[model samples]
Each structure stands twice: as structure tokens, then as C-alpha cells.
Target: MLAQILPWYAHAAQRTAAAPAQALTAPARMGWSTHVGFGPGAEILGRDLRGKRLLELGCGPGHNAAHLAKHHQAQVTGVDLVGLQVRRARSHYGHIDGANFAVGHALHHLQATEQTFDAIYSVFGAVGLVAPELLLAAIARRLNPGGVLAFSVPHPARAGRHPSTDDHARESHVTVSDLIRLPLARWEFDAHRWGAHLSRTGLRITSTVDLRHPRLDPWPTTLLITARTR
Candidate 1:
């Protein structure tokens, strides 16, 4: 998993660094299109962010953490497995009073830290990258009881294509039917599979929202899941 994401995010760092300072300074828009356009305009995670202890997994460049700290009064810690992404986030948003960035794998951090959070979230993070059992075990330890865990994962429809021969392809887009035979590493789950996976993790699913690109239909979408620690 580390081997896969490190190079991918290294590429992301180069791409993200080239943006204008003004654009970088602006708070991050929620990366999903889902129902509405980009940004947190739809408030998919609900509206109770004030004074919460929040952690964002796979927070590339830390823009959303900075935004939450600045606007929502949340004490935010953003972690990414890749060091370059974490460094970029620190360089960009380290000055913010409530935003902190760390470079570490989420599962390892969750295991080692004494801290617990009111909520934990990932836009397109652990739910896809790590296996459910591994991720949930670590999360069960760090998330406070009844704490919210909100995350988004590529909809099962994305698994349509067969895995590409090229090692460089980050995402090989295809339909859900094609995914059954392909030997892909990323975990893309249907609602039933997701429900079963979470049940064993001591996390109870409260809702699952389907988010797709507004302009693009059926091909690529995300399942935004909100769960609570049991």
C-alpha cells in the first residue's frame, strides 16, 4: 500500500505545487461533486463542526484541514502516508492556529497515539487504500465511542475496467461488472459488502450517500459513508 501511494502522491505534490499562490491560499472545496457542485456547499458531513477534535486521513496538501480549522473552529490534524504531501501541507498551512499536519500511515498513527477524536474523515482516503479489517481495527482504538467516522470511497461502478498493464495507471476506470474478475488492489465495495465489513469493525453505518460527478453520469461516483463507533 505504501509503495503504491508514495509515488502517486509524489506526482500529486508536483502538480499541486504548481498552482498559483492565490488559488493555494483559498480553502479547499470538498473534492466530491455528489449532488451539488464542488466545495462544502452541500455539507455532507452534517453541520456540527464547531470545537471538535478532528482528524483527516490522506489529507493531501492539507487545504481542507486548514479550511476546517479556520472556518469551523475545529482542531484539525491532517495525516498522509506520503512525506512530501505532509511537507507541502505544513509549508502551506502550518501557520494556522488549529491546523496541524503529520506524515504517517493512518493505521500506525491511530495505534500509537494516545489522542482520540470527536470525528475522523477522509475524502478519498483509507476506505479505498487500506483493507477494511486493517483500517477499522486501528480506527476502533482511536475513535471515541459514538464518534463519527465519515469517508468517501469510489463507487463500485469504478471497478468496471480490468487492471492496466502499465504500473503508472492510478485508476483504471471501468464498470462494476468488470471489477469481479480484475485483480485490483484498491477496495471498492457495494453497499451490502460495505455494511458487512463495517459490522465486524464495531462501527455502525448510519447512512451512505451516493456522490457522482454532476456533469458525468454512471461512470464514476463515490459512496459517502457516515458511521459511528459502537
Candidate 2:
């Protein structure tokens, strides 16, 4: 399933790479939701991250990783499936003191690396794109004992779709510039279901945050979940 989506992400990388480069500075604040400053920020991870080992799954363009490394002084390693995206990340943030970017599958990278992280996070990244059970299990193996895992996904209600009762992924589309739509598969689950999955994978749920649209939308636009490895 992930293999099928690589080309789409690669195309997206190419398009984004061609655009004018933004200022090479990390964001002043970290955001978990699609909307800027809508939900909880970096405080979800902790008040301080200096000297911490961190991993970011599906770190497109490495912006968040850069923010963590530059602002919080974390040793952040970012991995993405698309090579072009990885290159773009390196080009943009490679000079940051504690930030590094690599190209590979999240599961494979997590399993292959010998090092363990203090925290592993995904911001609308691999947590939803990959199979939950497999990815969560791999994350558990890569995290140090009592480590943190935080990720965000589109709220099921945002698309007017009910959360899946089972573990299978549902078909979805990634809209680009309101013109190009790319096919993809993503898993959607309510907080209870996600808690169950995390528990089964040896992770204890810490908190869940629902970020509703600013305009009083009926449903939340993003759901952020945080867990700790047991």
C-alpha cells in the first residue's frame, strides 16, 4: 500500500522543490494540526527537549524536525519514503546543527537503526499512511523504555466519514492546490480505537487532542494522539 503512494509523493516533492524557496528559518512555534496554531504545540512533547534523541516519521521537507532541533536543541532524525522529499529536506535544513534527514520506509528505518529515541512523532505523517499495528509495533521497538510517541491525523468527521470500526485503511485523496488530486489510503479511527491499538502495541495513551476548525465547524479538523512506550 505504501509503495503505491511513493510516486504521488515524489511528484509532490518535484513540484514543491521548483517553487521559490522560503526563508531558511525554523518556525517560532510547532503545530500538530493542519491549521497553523490551531491545536497544542511542542508542549505536548515536553517543556524541554535539549540533548534528547528524537525521530520524525514522514517528515516532509523537514520543517518540524528543524524546529525541534534548532529551537529545542534536540538531536532529530527525520525519515521519509520519497527520495526527492528527502533531498529537499536536506537542502533546506541540512545545515541545522542537530537535524538530519534520511530516505527510507518508516518501518524499515526504525527496525534497521540501532539507536533508540527519547521520542518518536508524526505530524499527519506515517501514523495514518501505514498500517497501524505494524508501524506502532516497529515504533515500540525503536523507542527507549518510557519514550514518547505523538502523531496527528485528519479527523474522521472532517471528511464527513465515520471512523472505521476495524483496522483496515480507507481510500483517500490528497488535494494539491485545489487542482490535482492524488489517490492514497489512510486509516481513520476515533480516540478509543486508537487507544486500544496503542495499548496492544505496548504503548500507554497519555492524551488526545481534537482541534476543531476555527469557524465553529461541526467536526474537528485534526486529531492528535500522544502515547508513551511501556
Error of 1 at 39 (Å): 7.8
lDDT tens per residue, model 1, 136-173: 76776788877888887767665353322332224422
Model 1 clash tally, residue pairs: 4
Find the candidate with the highest TM-score and give its number: 2
Q: Candidate 1 vs. truth: CA RMSD?
A: 6.2
Off by over 4 Å in 1: 20-36, 39-42, 159-184, 218-220
lDDT of 2 by residue, 42-136 (tens): 88887789999999998988889999999999999999887877777887888899999998889889889999999999998889888889999
What TM value does model 2 have? 0.93
What are the lDDT figures for the candidates, one per model? 0.70, 0.85
Q: Give the TM-score of candidate 1.
A: 0.79
- Model 2 whole-model lDDT (C-alpha atoms): 0.85
Clashing pairs in model 1, backbone N/Cα/C closer than 3 A: 34-211, 160-174, 160-175, 161-174
